[model samples]
Target: MKNVFIFTVIGLLFLSCKPEEKRTDYIINGDASGVYNGVRAYLKEKDRTGRERIVDTAVVVNEKFTFTGKVDIPKPSVISINSVNGNLNFMLENSVIDISIDKANISQSQVSGSASQTDFDAYNQGYAKLKKESVDLQNELRNIHRQLSSGSSEQLQSKKDSLTDLFTAIRQKEQDYPLNFTRTNTDSYYSLVIIEREINKKNANIKDYQEAFNNLNSELQSSAAGLYIKANLTTLMVAFEAKSRVDIGKIAPNFEAPTPEGKTVSLNDIKGKVTIIDFWAAWCGPCRRENPNVVNIYNKYHSQGLEIIGVSLDGTRSQKDPKQAWVNAIEQDKLSWTQVSNLSYFLDPVAQLYNIQAIPAVFILDAEGKIAAKNLRGNALEAKVKELLAL
Candidate 1:
């Protein structure tokens, strides 16, 4: 009997030492009240290319549905119902989350049980207020613009100016909110998401994003989003440096390329009292549309010491006879200025020197070949050229 008791004790101790199973899967219990049976709910997420793709699907039976999945980290997901106009957005994590769906208004649906979702909700709530204010300001500005279109009066102009100032202030606030949220909510995983988004914006301040990432707690800094931002910072830093190299007041980088007639021409060769380095492409609709204005500007000011070097980004591997297309566009658009191209599209060496990401990019230079202004269009371009030429 003593031996039996000792063996039983040993077995109990062994059972006690066994490890508990870790829960890695998430289960979503959804209550689509007032919705008819057999409706499908799609779980959606964005792929690396920013395309929305379905991750899972479940059908509502008796106004109830369930979704089961595993995610390495919290992900922003959407639950879209069949025949519904809007989506129910939530942060999907490995937890049992309960969602009470409002079929008539999916965005207003209630969610609980995921800490990440709670934080996401808080962030949205703050952002929505600013968004509403921006919308209101935009509406007012549109109304004033409509009035100005009919006729211009000093009072209407004054009101338009006042509304423009308000709109600008609200927009600045909207841009600052996400960064401010990251600073105050460093512990929240959503902060890392915000930082990643800010890092991707055009002309994003890398210094500010770096500071915000550093302020995050160690755990968040080690998360998937944080690591992505860290890894891409080096590339982004390089791009930022390139931008600084061509900034206004910096000497425009000089390069030579083949002209339409097969002669090599450099910026220094065509340098004048005022020079306009116009980056354009054959297939770009916007560049084509803006060409007339450029031609007009050249005709008006070329005799007044204004020089234009049209750097054509007019070739792609997919294009048949890229040089033919470049020559055709120049003749078709009536671009009379000295035109040059390597016929390599965006891969053209001169485009890379100017850091041209989009077509219709313009760099206006002073007599000394320093970039005086950039990206000016229409009246702004004409005005700057006129001022620089002392016309």
Candidate 2:
């Protein structure tokens, strides 16, 4: 009985002493020849606010540095070393990684240990080919455009045809590559990563992004990349809707904001007339110069059922108050129109609704509030107004 009890107690002690299973932790150790001895390394992951969250930091020790952390799953993080030698942006996954960074040949640096990194290597190799071809085609198109002014009529037509083909091929390939890859690799989490990266391109179409997103695996849809896509996808949809509204033959999206006199004015207030939706900011020198042209057009066309609705992008700043500036500019420029603003600058809700990319933008709306034209400046603005009024 004594031996039996002793054995039982020993077994219990052994059981209690056993180490728990190790969590998913990563150790990134690497050497860079050109880095300063005490240079800091920042490990970062992007957050929803379009900013990076510093996961950790390590200082170079004895020409080597190490970082240790636990990752619930694979994450796309960057090891950024900003030093006197230059900046090194090394992309890595959250796994035990051995980095071999060549300062002189940084692009050719080798990173091993993570399966996802291996996949990244392969993806970039293929992507490089397509990007190279796209760049070459773009260069050729630019050179062709430079010759447009002096080209013979037939030559110009031929150049135009070539330019169209090259441009179309480039866009189609960029769009199709992600769509085809995501559709073929539905279960691949990295597929969502690639789509997330590509969908942020300025030329990305909403339909393509949606199709690719839907094709992703359900598990991937719950991943970090998927969440990033979901957030940006919402922004893209808003921009897409706004873009469509400003296109010719589409009705304008109505908005209401406060005028300089604290009176609220809405786009619908100026309906039943040919109205110009002018997007301008008080700080824009060109916008101030262009104000006279707009004034002239309004004066000449105001009698013929022409109306103007100016949307000022001006907002207050710490150094200067934009409301006073906006009011001053209006009075000085003699802009006699129904103007409104929320004073939020680019973040102005109305500007975002119309997808206003730059100042001095205008959408000429017809009598029924459908966009008849856009970006009609100087004589073009006057001519379009005249033509619309005649109709």
Off by over 4 Å in 2: 1-23, 26-69, 77-91, 94-104, 110-113, 135-164, 175-184, 192-211, 228-244, 247-249, 254-273, 278-292, 302-361, 375-377, 387-391
Can you write out model 1's per-residue Cα lDDT over 1-391, one digit (the tens) per residue? 9999999999999999999765699999999998889999999986545578999999999999999989887878899999777998788888989999987899999999998898899999989999999999899989989989999999999998998999899999898998889889888887877777778888898877788889999988787767877888767878887888899999999999989889999999999999999998888899899999999999988998999999988888778888888889999999988999998888888988889999889999998899999999999999999999988
Best by lDDT: 1
For model 1, name the residue pairs that clash.
none
* lDDT (10s digit) by residue, model 2, range 1-391: 9999999999999999999764467888777766778887777776534477788888987667788877655656666665633333344555678987666765576788876676667666767888888888788877777777666577777877887797788777865776677777777666766677766777677767777788777777877667768788888877777787677898898999999999998999886478999999888889999999999988887887889989998974751888999999899999998989999998999999888889889999888889999988999888888888875
Write down the lDDT of every candidate, Cα atoms only: 0.89, 0.79
Cα TM-score per model: 0.64, 0.56
Cα lDDT for residue 362, candidate 1: 95
